[model samples]
Target: MTAAPAFPPLVEAYLADLEHALAASEPRERAETLAAVREHAAESLALHGSDDAGARRVLDELGPVDAIAAASTPAAPAAAGAPAAPAATPAADVWLVVLAVASLALFVVPLVAAAAVIWAVVRLRAGVGNRRVQTLALAVGTVSLVGAAALYVSHVLAG
Candidate 1:
């Protein structure tokens, strides 16, 4: 096996700080910020002479960890404007009901539907609204239900 490339101490510290900052950020912004940090580190390593002092200097120039985290995070809307109204609780309940109906349809359908509904509800409760999660749940539930129906029909035909 090839030997792993070693990072200088300062470079390692910078990377650790970057990781912490990325972890504290929202999921939506994480990818882009991570890419930027990775690119910057690569560029810095390439330009700097291979010396600990050089790495330290580069990291120091990059500034503090908190500043980096703040810069990477998306700014929340200013409170000057009227606050947006909360989403209707009943809508989420409706989604849960639909999920329940889909789950009752067949074998694996209920399991998949229940998982999706549970995941969406948990995310919503945690103040995360992901349209992708909702869409995935709906699609998976429908497909499973349809598959279950088709299997039942085939069995009847065979009988």
Candidate 2:
């Protein structure tokens, strides 16, 4: 078997930093991670034929000390008995827009449009409608109702 390769001071310093960063990890875990990193460095050195510059290249590929340490740490496990989260419900904006459009029937039939607008408001307050689109619907509905009322009053005055 061939003797192990000796890395330059820079590579040693990088490894030292990596070890320091991983100190909080379990001993066996830390050793395993460090060993892998060393193995990679050794292989890179062999390919480069003992060139010290290869150490920097190998360590660079291994990534920064902090990143390696962070990667080695796992997230906390969830409680065994907890229920999984439910899927999200679809937004109600489409129906709200439909109602808003229906409300514009105020020009043709004020009573129908009024009912549609009332229903839209109820949905908005109930949190069923999407806020952004519902606001635009409210504007359209209000304009249609107002225009209808104005036309009705004008017709009566002209007649």
Candidate 3:
């Protein structure tokens, strides 16, 4: 039998999409899906007996890459089953106000308070679920820190 021609590009693209979908999926689920995809691709290629046609068929069976990625991801947890939490409040606004007040008093206490604000901002940015609030807090905290530093420098220069 004549050897089938190589379809490197098509195969590579298919593999890339598969990998992307895997990455977006949960760790345990990703492993299973990856194994299934590998096996399916191999089987299709063997059955088709031509690399180009095999790759095309495999990709068609897999469906859209984005759809696969979305499917593999876990759904966001619903609030119904959990305890009744308080309604969502603008916590970031409150935090910004607190930080601003703290910043003014920080001048007498030196950088300690300013450092605390910076630390809180970093923690918020890292762990907070609300991206908008995290970003606002970070911006306000950063500005406060910079202002505090400038005040300290000016104080020393004047004295």
Candidate 4:
């Protein structure tokens, strides 16, 4: 009625530009393809409340016709022989693995082994390194250190 845009020249021009740009698409698909674009422009107009400047801004954001057409086209495939490289293990993890193995000497070197176990527990809780390997290291160190402590406690009680 009186509130409507009977002469929405900018909107008409934008749609015409979009149609020309979409010439590469199949004739049957052109209408369906532009459905989303039309909906967006309508929504923009509604939000801006019949303002022509808002309509112009939305059309500007859609950019030139050629660019829109190019964007809709599929990208070219990657060239052959481009395999990705494997990730390297962290230095801290390597040290943790070594210490976990050494922690088996709990009886001969309780303090160092106990320290190693504590380090492993901290690392394990913090989710450091590869899970399976860190878990194995933690298990080995924890059991040996606990055994060492149990033996020391029993020896003191027996005396």
Candidate 5:
């Protein structure tokens, strides 16, 4: 493979500073920012001439490393009354509700009810889902499982 083009010492120092500033960012974010900046520097240096003056001009356009790092970091929650992004519910939580309802409808089958109960318990332990929905699902699933067990016992006794 061809060797990478050598950057001037000034450009190298700026990149080092930027990398240090980004140390606390997510790995993917840090990598992406570094790569983008490196490419921009290369392109700018080629166009402006690869000298100390050109490196300074490119770094100036990119702004201070601290500023870039702060921008890369996630923002704090919006102040009260500011529009907030909606919390995303996981799909498994949605499925938990559906399975709970299905367990109620199919409570005659012990296996279906048992499956729903297991899923509800697992999700509850994982600390996910809407609070009310999780409670309802667990309650419904447990009741349905109990009913199915009772029905199974009765059938065995009778037959």
Candidate 6:
């Protein structure tokens, strides 16, 4: 197996600082940000030739770790005693609900409904959507899937 590319000391130190700076971010967001930044640094190193000078250049282009962390982090609540803001419903959640509802048409168009059910299940598993919406999608999608399967089995047995 090929060895993993090694970063210069400067790049490694920058990554360490970045990790510390991102400590307050959501775990998923932190991991994603770090991974993307690491990949970019690797690409930059490859382009510039892996060395302290190249790493310095890459870090310069990236700016300070604190600035990067600030850009990635969500804004703080306006007041210390104020309630945290509710997360907005993601677009994917909206689509999941649409697909789950559309699954009701399974009796008339099994393929479309099947696709909808599949999409709903995938989105629900990702756990990225609002809880209430995800629950609705899962419930509706399950019912449709079961109904479609029953209808298919009955038709097959009848013929």
- Comparing 4 and 6 by lDDT, which wins? 6
Candidate 1 is scored at a TM of 0.39
Report the number of the highest-lDDT candidate. Answer: 5
Candidate 4: lDDT over CA atoms?
0.70
Residue-by-residue lDDT tens digits, candidate 5, 1-120:
966567889899999999999888877889999999998988999999899899889988889989999989653454777888877777877888888889889998767777777887
Pairs of residues at least 3 apart in sequence or in different chains that clash in candidate 1: 103-110
Candidate 4: pairs in clash: none
Superior by TM-score: candidate 1 or candidate 2:
2
Please give, for residues 1-72, the per-residue lDDT of candidate 2 as tens digits: 967557777788888999899887767889999988888888887786555677767777888898889877
Tell me the spans in candidate 6 whose CA falls farther than 4 Å from its real position: 1-81, 124-127
Cα deviation of 73 in candidate 6 (Å)?
A: 7.5
- Model 2 clash pairs are none
Q: Report clashes for each candidate as comma-separated counts.
A: 1, 0, 0, 0, 0, 0
Model 6, 1-159: lDDT tens digits are 966568999999999999999988877889999989998999999999887789899999889998989978664655899887888998988887787788886545566566766776677677667878877877887777788878889989999
Worst 10 residues of 3 by lDDT: 107-116
Question: For candidate 2, which ten residues in a row score worst on lDDT?
Answer: 87-96
TM-score of each: 0.39, 0.43, 0.40, 0.41, 0.46, 0.49
Structure candidate 5, residue pairs in collision: none
Candidate 6 positional error at 5, Å:
25
Candidate 1: 10-residue stretch with minimal lDDT: 88-97
* Between candidates 1 and 4, the lDDT winner: 4
What is candidate 5's local distance difference test score?
0.84
lDDT score of model 6? 0.82
Q: Please write out the lDDT profile of model 4 over residues 31-129, one tens digit for every residue.
A: 666776777777777777546787787777667767767666532335467774655766776777778677676455677567667777777788756
Better of 3 and 6 by TM-score: 6
